[model samples]
Target: MKNKELVENYYKDVFINGNVDKIPVYIAENYIQHNPQVEDGQAGFIKFFKNFIKTEPKIEIINVSCEGNMVYVFYKCSLPDGTINKVCDIYRVESNKIVEHWDVIESHVEKIKSVNHNSLF
Candidate 1:
């Protein structure tokens, strides 16, 4: 499979399914994750994600765009508390293997409240 396809499948099967083992299949041995919550390499990423999805089981990929060796995915996670977080993940692939990743996460509640302006005082 192409790098983009492999990266997509990694999110679908691994992230959504909570399959930690799939990390090795899609991630390179020297993979580096730029998230503050996760250390370098696939092992750290797997650990962080496993714990993350425990309370945030509902996840959806909103969009994806790829160019050259880079792939960008926009997603959302619904927490158990009924809160939603918008997230963006960027992947850098080489030789069909994901070598680097970066992510940004922000809660949607503040944005919704600010836009609606319907909050009770």
Candidate 2:
């Protein structure tokens, strides 16, 4: 599969559909996570979500695109308390499997919390 398609399917199955079993299909066994909070490899990826999905937060995909083997996905994540977060995930696909991952996450800022000139979206 293409890099973009692989990432989109990953977000759909794992985050939107709440299907954790699809990890093996879309991700590589040696998956390396750049996020300091998560460990390396696919096992770490799955284990992290096992506890995280307990709140049943929903994922809203905004955009997905690719440049060569690198895929970029931007999405909105709704937390259990109704707070919204903006997320951008980047992945590198090799031999049709997602081998590397990186993510940036930011929570939506309320008007009262807006101390800067930047928009959250």
Candidate 3:
């Protein structure tokens, strides 16, 4: 599969659906995570997602793009606790598997709280 497609599938299966069992199919065994909060490798990925899935955040993919082996995804997540977050996820694919990942997350501010009154999405 193409790099963009691979990463998108990974996000849908793991993040959107909370299906950790499919990790081996899309993630490399030695997956490198640049996010300081998460650990490296597939084991770490599984551990982190297992806990994250407990809340079952609703994920909406906004955009997806690819450059070389890198794929970038922009999305929004709404947690069950009423916290909304906008996230940009970057992934590096090798041999049809996601080998690396980095992400930036920002909490969405309500329109009433923003001076510009613009949506974060």
Candidate 4:
């Protein structure tokens, strides 16, 4: 599968479905993570998500783009507590495996809180 497809499948199976078993298939054994909150490697990835699923966030992808070996995914997720977050993730794929990742996340502000009422999407 193409790197873009690989990333989509990974998100579908793991992030959306909460299937941790697919980690080995889509992620490299020595995966490098740029997210300071998370640890390095597949084991760390799995460990981190184990806690993440507790929130039961409904993950929704907004857009995706790919160039060379990098795939960028934009996501809007609804937290179990009713808050919303905008997340941007970048992944480096090699040999059909995700080898590195970086992400930025911020809580979405309601329109009333915005200065100009520009759309968050």
Candidate 5:
């Protein structure tokens, strides 16, 4: 698979399914996750995400784009309490594996309350 496809599938299988087995396959050994809550490497990334997914199972990816070594994705996560958050993630690929990642997250309180707010993610 191409780097973009690998990343998209990795998010689906791992984040949505709460699977950690795929991390070793899709993430580089020296992977660096830039999120403040996560440490360096895939292990830290997996641990952080495992906690996230367990608490927020209704995560969905809305869109993804790839350019050169970078992939950008937008997503929405519904917390167990019904609050929703919108998030954007950027991944840098090297040798067909994700080597670096960064993300931004914001709570979509108003959007979540509006029944007409169709999820973009």
Candidate 6:
């Protein structure tokens, strides 16, 4: 599969659908996570998501871009409490498996609260 499709499917199945069993299909055994909250490797990934899914957050993908072995995905996550977070995730794929990940997450700001009056989505 293409890198973009691989990462998108990973997010859809794991993050959105809460399917942790499919992690091995897309993630490398030595997966590196740049996010400070999550540790390294597939074990850490499963551990983190196991807790994360309990929040029942919903995800909506905004955009995707791929170049070489890297795929970048921008999306919005709506927490059960009605708070929204905008996230940009970058994944590095090698040999058809995602080997590394980095991300930036920001709380969604209302247009009225913005000096530029622009939507974060």
Give the local distance difference test score of model 5.
Answer: 0.82
TM-score of each: 0.86, 0.88, 0.92, 0.93, 0.85, 0.93
RMSD of 5: 2.7
Candidate 5 residues 16-121, lDDT tens each?
Answer: 8778888888888889888888989878887777777768658777888999899998887887787777889899999889999999888765354445657445
What is candidate 1's lDDT per residue for 13-41, written digit by digit as tens? Answer: 88888787788889887888888778888
Candidate 2 residue pairs in clash (backbone atoms < 3 Å)? none
Each prediction's whole-model lDDT (CA): 0.81, 0.84, 0.88, 0.90, 0.82, 0.89
Q: What shift in Å separates residue 11 of candidate 6 from its native position after superposition?
A: 1.6
Best by lDDT: 4
Runs of candidate 2 with Cα error greater than 4 angstroms are 108-119
Q: Give lDDT tens digits, candidate 4, residues 1-116.
A: 99999999999999999998888999998999999989999999999989998889899899989999999999988886778888999999999999999998887533237667
Give the least accurate 10-residue stretch of model 1, judged by summed lDDT: 112-121
Kindly report which residue stretches of model 6 are placed more than 4 angstroms away from their true locations once superposed.
Answer: 108-112
* Model 1 C-alpha RMSD to native: 4.0
RMSD of 3: 1.5
lDDT at 103 for candidate 1? 83
Report how far off residue 98 is in candidate 6 (Å): 0.6
Candidate 6 structure quality by residue, lDDT tens digits, 1-121? 8898899899888988889999989999999999999999999988998898998989999999999999999998988787788899999999999999999888753222766756777
Model 5 regions more than 4 Å off:
108-121
- Once fitted onto the true fold, the runs of candidate 3 whose alpha carbons sit more than 4 angstroms away are none
Q: Per-residue lDDT of 1-121 in model 3, one digit per residue for the tens? A: 8888888888888888888899999989999999998999999988998888998789999999999999999998888778888899999889999899998888753323666756777
> Could you give the C-alpha RMSD of every candidate to the true structure, in order shown?
4.0, 2.3, 1.5, 1.5, 2.7, 1.6
lDDT of 2 by residue, 30-94 (tens): 99999999988999999988887997887877788899999998887887787788889999999
